[model samples]
Structure formats: C-alpha cells, structure tokens
Target: MTTTGTSSSDTTATGAARPGGPGQLAGRTVSRVGFGAMQLERLRGDRRGALALLRRAVELGVDHVDTAHFYGNSFVNGLLREALRPEDGVLVVSKVGADPDPGGRIPLRPAQRPEELRASVEDNLKSLGVDQVPVVNLRRLDSGPGLRAEGDQAVDIDDQLAAMTAMRDEGMIGAIGLSSVTAEGLRRAIPAGIVCVQNAYSLVARDDETMVEMCAAEGIAWVPYFPLGGAFPGIPKVTEEPAVLAAAQSLGSTPSQVGLAWLLQHSPNTLLIPGTADPGHLEANIAVGAITLDEATVASLDAVPSRSADVRIG
Candidate 1:
C-alpha cells in the first residue's frame, strides 16, 4: 500500500443543473430520489435490458446514480457507460473497497491500502469510461466475520481517507464519500471533507439514526443503501410489518412506496438510492418522492420495532 498522503480539492465537472424534486447532493443540486445500479447484476446475461432500464431512469429525470465498478465484477459500470452520456447531467457516484472475486462473492476485507485504493479508483474510471469519477466513496466494512473479531488493524480509516484525498488532489476523482460507517467513523472522516455517507438504513433497519441526524447537521448526504428490506441481511423486514401494510392500504400506496416516502420526509440531507433492475419497479421508486405522509402516519410508522437491538448486519 503506497501512502503518499497528498490531499486536494475535487476536480469533477461542476455546476450540474438541479432536476425538479428534492434538493442538493454534496453541494451540487440534484434529484433527491437517486437510482442504484447494484441490483442489475441479477439480470444475468440481459445486458441490453439493463441498459434500457438505465436509459429509462434518465428519461424520468433521475440526475443522481449510485454505482460501483466492483458491482457485477465491473458489468454494471460497463452498462452505465453504454446507456448514458456524460453530458446527460447525471452525477455518477461509484465506490471502491468491496470487490467481487472470481467466485462472484465479495469477501469483506480491509483492502483500502493507498495503492490498492488508487487502483480501485482507476478501475472505476476505466469501467465507467470517465476521466474522473463524479463521486467516489471509500467503503468501510463496519461488520464482518473476521473483521468484527480482529478490529482496527483490519481497516484503518485514516489511511483510506488519505488515499482518497490524494486521488482528489491529483484530479483523479471528484468528491469523496464513505459507506457502512459509524458516528466515530464520520468524526474521523470529517476532516477529509466527506461529502456523503452510504449506510444500511431504513424504517426497520434504523441502526444508523444517529448517523442520519449527524449527516443532516453536518450537511453530508446520507445515502441509505436498502431503504426497503433489501441489501443487508438479518435486519427486520419493513414491508412485512403490520403497521406498514395498514398504512400502505390507508394511503393507497404500495408498502415499498410508503417506506420510500417516509425516507424522503425523514431528513433533507437523506438521498434515496433504491435499487431495481425491473423497469416498472424503477418507475415506482422514483415516484416515491411525491407521496407525502401525515404526522399521524409518520408516528404510527415509527412505532414499529426499529431500535438498533432489533437490527443486525452481516
């Protein structure tokens, strides 16, 4: 791992015009309801279908897209390259740290050594066909088998931040973001000028409530990975809850839509990146920004067992 420790300001394309909907992301105004490309890997060999879905997202005025070169072993980024143009006004946010091995399973490890981090950023650039990534997140593994048992040596947050900061200074990346981070991690990352934090959070998976409020206060974009019951395993499923179902029926909205609506109203800095390879689901996910929930409904939804003790991440 090379540790040159040269940090600089971001040099990505500036002045991205905001699309109609919720406000700014990382100081650049954008649609609050963003699209996540992780689920596209499940499409298998349907690359054409994946491309079409991405294009449809753009057509629907989605200006923010969350992706990673490691997703689908670089397949998702390749699809994004073919589907959308750089001038389309889409702010592509990618991550480095988690990589899918040849077996197609991303074994969690502390691979954020400076040189590896730089190489991962370059890999994202090459796969997405961009000179500088619009936003690159340094994903930290907060919980895993070996990682949980071993502790800090598994992943040094400062070293990883230094590497990303170096890349930003070198004009290889735009803004910097972090994923799967705790409040302490955020505190350590603040000096690095972190623009966002992507963590496993939702109605049921509400372990990161403090982190959410911290991001809101610090003006950092809180990108929740699984707004629904998807992504992280072991967290209590929100969609299957009785209150969620009753509220969905009362509001005449799908459970998924209700969950997303709650998130949109949860915090101003909260950015939704619900993933779906299905075109129909994609439309529904974007439309979630419009569903307004009353205070009574919000209170009732909160009553569901969302405490951290009830949630678990694998």
Candidate 2:
C-alpha cells in the first residue's frame, strides 16, 4: 500500500498482443476477455492445479485478471501471486465491499463502511503481494443479487469515494472502478475518474444495457461478471437460449462461446472476465474473441427476451 500508482500519460494500452482482443481497463491496455479468479476457491486444496491453470491463462496472452480479497478468504489472491509475474504486465483488478465469512454458509458478509473499504484495499495488497493494485473496484452494496449493506454498513457514496481518492492520490492504488452500481451511481462517481464498471450482464441478461453504453461513451471499461449467466435464481443462463444454441451449431462453436462473442461485439468497451476451474474451459473462454456472429445471428440473439435477475456478480 506504500507504492505510488503507475502514473502515466498514455491513456490506454495498445493491446493487440494480448488475448480476447485489446481494450482498456484501469487506464492500461488489457485483453477484453480476462480471467476471473473467484472459481479457484474450489481448488483451494489443490495449489499445484490452481497454479497450473493460472499459468496457462498467461500463456494464452491473457493480460487482465479480476479478483477480490474475500474470494476464498484470500485463497485465490495467493494463487495469483504465485502464478502471475508482475513483469508480464498482467493487470490485477480487485473489488471491495465484502469480506469472507468462513463460518457462514454463504461465506461472504458486507464490509461496506468507508474505513472497511480502505482496510480491504490493504488486505488485497498483502494477499496479492503487490506494491500497488492497478485497480480497486468499490463494490457498492446499495443494491444487489447478493448481500446488502444494512445499519452501519450503509455509508454514503461520497464518503466511500473520499477514502478511495485518498488511496489513489497517495499511490496505494492506480485507479478506481465500480461494481454492482446503478446508472445514478455511475454518474455520481464520474468525477473520480472511474476506469471501469463490473455489473451482471450477458446476452440473456441485458438489464444494464444503458449503463454499458454510458461507460462506452465515457471511455470507461465495462467488465461484465457472470458473462455466460449462472444457475443462481433469476440469473438466466445464456447457453440455454435457442438462438445461442442455433448460432453455436451453425458456427461450429459452443453455446457458451457464442454468448461471450456477442458480448464483445455488443460494445467495444465491454470486457469479459469469465471464470472457470477447468483448463479446457479457460482456453474456450479466452478463444471467444475469435468467434464472430454475423449481423443476422447477432440480431436474432439480440431479439431474444431479456429478463431481470435477482442475482448479479457479487
């Protein structure tokens, strides 16, 4: 937390050399299709296996990774530390607003207070073994498909931003990002120089369509979590859609790949951080950039019904 931000004049990275095509995140060029380390918690007991998967991602030209200190109680962060080399220019993005609750069935509890957010940043630095986090997302608990802040946890956005600004100015962090935020929240946070937004969006889940476009217009990255959707209640799975399945068959790709490709083509600023513990799935997720959907297929997928989801990426 003592390191200064990698202050720079280059507003974006020329990421043609990276995977999933290049896009900006935290003011750096990173592959639009990055890796999400949350799923590595399932490999907590298999350190060797986890390390191998992460290494394989780097080999595929992945240059962006999204993680959180509360993920497996910092278990995933530790794996990133061992598997990723800072010299490789991998931009690690971490989110705060929740802490691991090992004793709870859900294993996560909101820690949204301003002071707690600051502490979470330091915890992430220590766990990930980084001098300065390239990007630290302030995951607002104002609304959620997950735990909501209550009582003292319900702090003002200004107060939270104040803490984050102090850290950025002092060089503890490189830039700021937001997650699980609404249109109004993103507007209020604009002056802070937000570099990205992580929301629950996918081909089947288009509730944040406007927000995604806003980010694009503002030169902010739109990092969608649960890009392929999941089994959670209300969060529809993208692979099950009839149009997606048909496109996969015609293009000789998986339904999952079709869903991911659509998101990339949906918005130029959109970044995908699909997580998987399987090596094969990791390769497929990164290879999504090569899958192209013609206008006709894209239109059909876009025509598919959009539904509201109770759960977004936490």
Best by lDDT: 2
Model 2: which ten-residue window has the lowest total lDDT? 1-10
What is the lDDT of every predicted structure here?
Answer: 0.76, 0.84
How does each model score on TM-score? 0.88, 0.93
Score candidate 1 by TM-score against the native.
0.88
CA deviation > 4 Å runs, candidate 1? 1-20, 104-110, 143-153, 230-233, 307-314
Candidate 2, superposed: residue stretches over 4 Å from native? 1-17, 312-314
Please provide, for model 1 over 235-313, each residue's C-alpha lDDT reduced to its tens digit, 9 standing for 90 to 100.
Answer: 5677888888988999898999988888888888888888898999988887787788999999999888773423333
Candidate 1, residue 232: Cα displacement in angstroms equals: 5.0
Error of 2 at 4 (Å): 10
Cα-lDDT of candidate 1? 0.76
